[model samples]
Target chain A: MPMNAQKSVLGTLGSRAWITTVWAVTIFFVINLLALIATVMTSSFGTRWLGTWLPAGWTVNWYASAWEEFQLGDLLTTTFEVVFAVVFLAGLIGIPAAYALARREFTGKRIVMLLFLLPLLVPPVTYGIPLATVLYKTGLGGTMSGVILANLVPALPFVILVMVPFVEQIDPRVEDAARVFGANTFRLFVHVLLPLLLPGALAALLLVLVRTIAMFELTFLTAGPDSQTLVVALYYAVFAAGVRAIQSIDAMAVVYMLTTLVWLLVALRFVNPTQMVTRAKRP
Target chain B: MSDTARNHHLPLKMRLSAAGFDGVTLLVLPAILLLVGFFVYPFFYGLWLSFHPKDGSVFGNYKTFFSDPFLYETISKTLWLSIPVTILNMATAVPIALRVRLMKNQRLLTTILVLPITLGTVLVAEGMLNYLGPQGWFNRTLITFGLISAPLKLVHNYTGVFLSLVITGFPFTFLLVLSYLTGIDPTLEKAAATLGAGPISRFRHILLPLLVPGLAVTFCLGFVQAFSVFPSAVLLGAPSGPTRVITIAAYEAAFEQYDYSLASAIAMIMGVVLLAIIGAVLAARSLFYRGPAGGGKG
Candidate 1:
């Protein structure tokens, strides 16, 4: 009896130690991450930063220079154009497909699901090479449309995957009720389904928007000099960092970070982050 | 009864609806068509392109890839970087997620963790270049505290790429694990405790078994993300040397060398390698218990 009691006390100490270790690691990670981000933020506005805990002087001139030198205004415009186009099209195409997958069972359903899952499962760079080849083959390569189309390969599927669960949560009997009330198929969709699906559709599209903005491999491969998005432009600035001011590049990095972060913040307000990956568990 | 009788007289849409190809079902076609055009077609086109290399006959690109040490070595190098990083991220995520699940401010913690993900690889790489640089705050703090005499070279090397992967990949792995952990009923753990199973035993006997399937998935997805590490590999690592991953090879082939066929071959190889890894993980997962891990609504 004494031994068993001693074992229990030891077990509690072990568990406590384990919990502390986990928290320590997590806090360490979080601190490092915050410091990393803070470094970039500070350097962006700093006049000189070399082997110091803090910069010699601070100024916002780098932001102005980065904006002008990188042509960020045009890049932001192009990015928004591509992102909005992809989001709008993905919603238009994906929501209806999600509704079908959720409400009805049919032949070849598994195959369809696999098709949607492939783009998400397969890394974009693996497929982006071939995709860029095909796009460049046709006249679409290096065009804004090409960027939008390449992005939609993943965005459409993502919307469908995220929305399918949302659609499934609505009872099928509700659709039947709408049908029995002398509603046509179009009317049933426009009036009855749209209202219920709006929140899900919004969540899905917002996510797609955030994803499109951040999607690098596809945009980097497919975009030309003229069609470069902000992320792609930022990549170029970093890649060819010898000529540009480091502070300016950091400023551009800050801009790119804020763009995606704002959308992600808004996205989190609508959808739980976990929902993004939950559909992966489905058979 | 009247509806059935009148169904035949209805339009082709109605007739198709009777066979389960309803208007709603047809809605899926546009998305399917898009995928077929962009994804399916490009994949096959790439395969076909791989067969017709620039210099030699069919299988030329594959032959070149295998024969050239520089080209072939990327597979191992990539696997070396990605596999370990994926494992580390998953391993770390499981414990942290388990703790976070029991926390009161789960959402806030999760949101903070997720910031790195939205920051994207390019920005993270850029940030790492500054923050982890010899002159950055990380080294400065260590030096100020007298932790080390000389500044560490954290960026522009393998350590740089590895650190960037953890920063970006950990949140994703954490989010997935947290979701899966939340799905398992807390009562099961309670039951285990009541049965005198210690916390470690409870986790090992109950949670680990339940989490294998989700872990397999998390690993694959995380592996895919880390495997195709491009921007960071280039911006943060010795891209031509240590971190010359398959994607980098493909990029160089297509863009730098302007060899589309070779690039296509490399891309195909990359895809195959990724699929093989994921397949193996899933297969191993089947060796574990595969049953409902949740209670209540699930």
Candidate 2:
């Protein structure tokens, strides 16, 4: 249908009430969300902000205090280490598995696919307790490696799920042609598949990076003092709130928000957020 | 025997490949092993731990959890918080997604909406404390506009937790519904319009049926996310009161009381409740039209 024709049809159908209500709801939600974030951002720089529309004074000292109080320098380094490790390891294990799952028809393929789905289906906290217990027994709990391993449970499956659709989209004939020209499996993947798969892999890993950064449950359950990610640290800071200044805490929040927002923006450039969910939903 | 000997003469890779474990297929092993070693094993371990209590018979933890109102009430508390929030998020998401699907600037709107999801529950909770607090901008503005005589008690209560869940969860629900709505071809609605069906009837007869399955899925996913409410419940909610959710109970059992067995039991119960709700929704989805939602060529 032509756009104007559809519009005429819609307009004549007297659906303006519905459209108006939707826009009202959406505007209401967006305005509140932005205001909430703006409140946090404004407070992070405010000198005093009690019972007032705006702060008495604005300063940047909270950032410095938050950095010192929260040990943010070390916290950021740990977060980056854990996030990168998860991204790297998930890619290494997940991409090839995705390729295989996408290309091949083998016995128990359904079962294999279900195995991947379960981790994503089950919330991390449901499993994180026992996993933490097991990690503690193995002397890995409260350690960086424990956090990394705990995170990979969801991250690896996410990578595989996201990459499967991407892998399936590749032309089989391309792989056949590579094989016909004397390419072995290794050579085929390296020379042909690698380049073709790069975009999808990067998108998947970038998403994994963003998810790992925000993954609080598993990281919180498994992390020790030194292994705590930024989100976990923020949770602790919030939970134990009396000692730290609210301004400094909001400053830490702004830092955390900026970190995730930067990565999310980068990720959105490569992938449509909605399409990613839809693709992952595919059987 | 002769076949086996001949097969044995080949490389191990080839031998394995003959049984359908080809080189490509074997790539899946590492991921499987990781899941097994981490996710699968731990789930069973938790289950097993739940059965064996530290101070009593095998069913001690379960008994304790059931008998204690404090522990058991968390179930109802959590369900009360999660179910309504999930329903509200999906209810709002459906209409908004329907609206956004027709708009020209869907991507920009979606990106803006998606900010909450990435900002996460903790940040949202933090912001809510300040934004919706007694002395915060929200109240000040409302009061300035003569909306209320006094600041409404929003944070550190059930209402605060509810707001936090909606703020963090609505984006996700919206995105999922939008994706599903977009997947349904616009021509279906157009066809209904051409046939002189009114807008409401066209939606009732066409879009509503197609959207049911997707709505069920959105409900389950959104419910799962909300049901696992942890940080928001603690930070934005009165954790010792109305928001003493199941996860908090489990955390207290494990960390505060140093009773891993009871915690594991609570975790297992949480999983079972979550799955049971999801299973019921999915089962109900079968009653609806289950064909391809899309009108386009696959």
Candidate 3:
């Protein structure tokens, strides 16, 4: 129906040809992505996928071996531990800052917002070196806390950026009404504002979780052997000086992708992923 | 000072009530402290470290980086790679984004396109190593269909890294353009159509002019992203060849050679180039900026 309208409106074969070309290219791109993913997923489970239409055999051994060799069970626990800590702290600190920035105008607010944006704007590796230097100098480096702190450089700002819009959506009169009803600041936050902010906070933290989980450069720079997240571990499993099975590495890749995909799916439920692209550009 | 002052204080408390600088500061201070302690301090520390080389000579690392051909060449090499990649990404993403916008399954399509992004660059590089490697499916299928007798050298080269960068970067560029495209008023196209303008004219006269600014912003952001090619450059590229971007140089300088000052200098160079490009783009964007109506949802 839309095409019919466009056809009449356009009334040109060249225009019709351009639309067809667009759809064709888009489909081709999508097919390539699916094929790439399918190839990796198949190799992870294939016993021998040696240059053929199908693998000669299949087994679950690669997954089991990857688990043992990469010690992914431990790495996964470390990932979750680091993710939860970063997410919780980001929400703890970022929500109030968002509330402040959203509700009240203050001197140097643009500068303050820019300061929050620096971490997200600059590449992590640019700052990771010196940040790790200080963390090491202060004796916090090579620990889970160090990794969490490094990730928080971006996560806190992200939470604040995400929450500002949510906070702005709420009317100020509700808070004024609560104040008039004899509520204190703390009580007003808990009783009146918390419920309204919950969904946004959840979405922000979930994005933070996904970001930190897939965050390679910061975690790689900061994490100790015991503190390594899954992506960092996967990086080592592939690049570190060792002879490892390709299938097992592929398995590890699948695991990391799934972990990130799960959170992304959850975050997508609450927030439009496309909005994140534009948000990063603006702030 | 008794009754009148007490009443004045009560009124002040009731009126302002956690809505002033004190309240904003109380809420914002923790985040500020964290940024200062982590982001600001480290950036300056890196700047400081860049000056004080291990040899105890000021500007020593900068001198070394400039003197060495391998290190110095990365400046041009990075530009060569990032510029084409950025241009190609925008070129392809524009039409694809426009098409995807009109689709009914827009969300699902975007979700699939964005899947690789969430997988992170490292995993994507790893996947490319396998899928694009010799004797991988790409080669096997070609040989099976008698397309080629010899397997192509796809991975462990410049081509491999370029492919990986495109895979990860294109989705982001596509999404950014799609959002900008959606924000354009459809009525303008309808108005042009009612005036008997063809689709080609409508696109050229109506859409193209409006999209130029958004496209410029997209190119700058996309260029910065592609310029910071780290994981893929290390994983997929021929490390010492045409793909020896500056980030690898910095990483090696810091970690391998354990030369902190040299690494910081290289990073500073990278940042300067990025900022210069972004500044230039923004400066150029303003020449074409059409105010509130042209730019969508700033």
Candidate 4:
């Protein structure tokens, strides 16, 4: 028994060593990545940072420069317009369909599900070109309408996918009870089902809003001068074949980061990232 | 109308209200129409566009794609970049995820890790341009620490884009592996221990078999995401040499050169490569595990 206990103690010590080593490495890696991001964030505010541990001085002028140079006021307003339209329209159409999918059985259900999966599975650029082509051919290209329409491709499907699980979790008997009280289909959706599904819908739509805002490829392909979202504009700011101050560009990047970070934090508050991952993989 | 007719109408209305095929179709049709119009139609159109050039030959665009050495180079280039990035991500993520899975601060760590993903790739690329530039802090810090005499040329090259991919790809890969690891029943490892399997043997015999499929899947997802590199390559990479990936080629062909058919052909090639990798991974998954993997039961 003494010998066995000694072996177990050695084994535990070995395991502890391995764990500590790996934990140290993880912390190192995470800090390095975060430090890189932090450098960018801090440098954006620095008036002129040189070879040093920290910037010699800090200023808000870069943010002002980025705002003026990037035409951020117009860009942000356009972004909000597109994001709101996408969220509202996707929710308007997707929630009822999710309720139908959850409650009603239908033929070709698997095929419908596959149709939804393709957009999420395939990379957006693979299809963005043709989608952009079609929009241009139809003369909807280079317009806000075109951007919103292109974004809807992914947002609508995503809403349906996310909402289906939420709808499935609801007790159908409550909905049926409303139906039994002589509520119409639309009324049941509005009065009873809507309240129950609000949390899920809110979570799903917030995510959709975030996705649409960050959806670069589709938006990049379809956006015109007037319709560029914050992300695409950031890309152009860097790659538009002109000289610009690095700090100014970094400021723009920070704005983009903060915009996405705000929405993601809100979405995370409602549905944690792990829950989002599991929910995404549910189908 | 008599009382009996009115009563019959109530049953018919109730049946419709319960949402049969017609009602369900009405509810679902708008979504179906939107997807078909925007998603499905565009894909077929892109495929069809690849086959029809102005010269009116179905094989012309593909022939041009294959014949041009500059355009053809991108295919191999994309594969080279993505494979290494994917492998590096998996290699780095496995150890970290394994550690994080057991840590009490997992949620906080994960949130910090996932912050980059929300920033979007373009912003990350822009940040990289500042953070990894010749005079950037990365080099400055290294120089300050007496680690190197000269600043490394990080951005506007393959090394720069590779670093960006790692920064963005690692979190996704880690998250996926961590999720899959949780699905593995801890009792399995404990059971192996009871049979006198040490940590190494227990991991090799039990955990490794379960982890392989998940790793392969992580690789596939990571590869695909990395494979579709455009904005990063343009922003942080040379875009004409070592880092001019296939998507960049396709984008230039379509948008820059106005050769839509050639662009479509390149896109098709890109799609084919991605699918082949995914299929290969999934096939290997079946070979490793005979039973259902996780299947949400573990």
Number of backbone-clashing residue pairs for each candidate, in the order shown: 0, 0, 0, 0
DockQ of each: 0.76, 0.69, 0.58, 0.56
What is the TM-score (0 to 1) of candidate 1? 0.95
Candidate 3: tens digits of C-alpha lDDT, residues A21-74: 978887877877777888889899999887577789998899999999999899
Q: For candidate 1, what is the DockQ?
A: 0.76
Top of the candidates by TM-score = 1
lDDT of 2 at A21: 85
Q: On residues B1-298, what C-alpha lDDT tens digit does candidate 1 reach at each position?
A: 6977788688987687666787678889999999999999999999999999988699899999999999999999999999999999998999999989998878777887778776689989998988888888888889989999999999888999999999999999999999988888899999889999977799899999999998999999999999999999999999999988888999999999999999999999998898899899999999999899975566
Worst 10-residue lDDT window, candidate 2 chain A = A274-283
Q: Model 3 segments beyond 4 Å from truth?
A: A1-11, A280-283, B1-20, B294-298
State TM-scores per candidate.
Answer: 0.95, 0.94, 0.92, 0.91
Residue-level lDDT tens digits of model 4 in B109-226: 8888777777778877876776777777778888889999999999999998898898888888888888888888787787789998877888788888988877887788788889
Error of 3 at A73 (Å): 0.9
Model 2: per-residue Cα lDDT over B9-50, one tens digit each:
899987766667786898898999999999989889989999
Q: Give all candidate RMSDs, comma-separated.
A: 3.0, 3.8, 4.7, 4.6
- In candidate 2, what are the lDDT values of residues A41-126, reduced to their tens digit? 99999999877789999899999999999999999999999999999999999998998899887778899899999888788888
Tens-place lDDT per residue, model 1, A193-246, is 999999888888987888789899999999998888999999999999989999
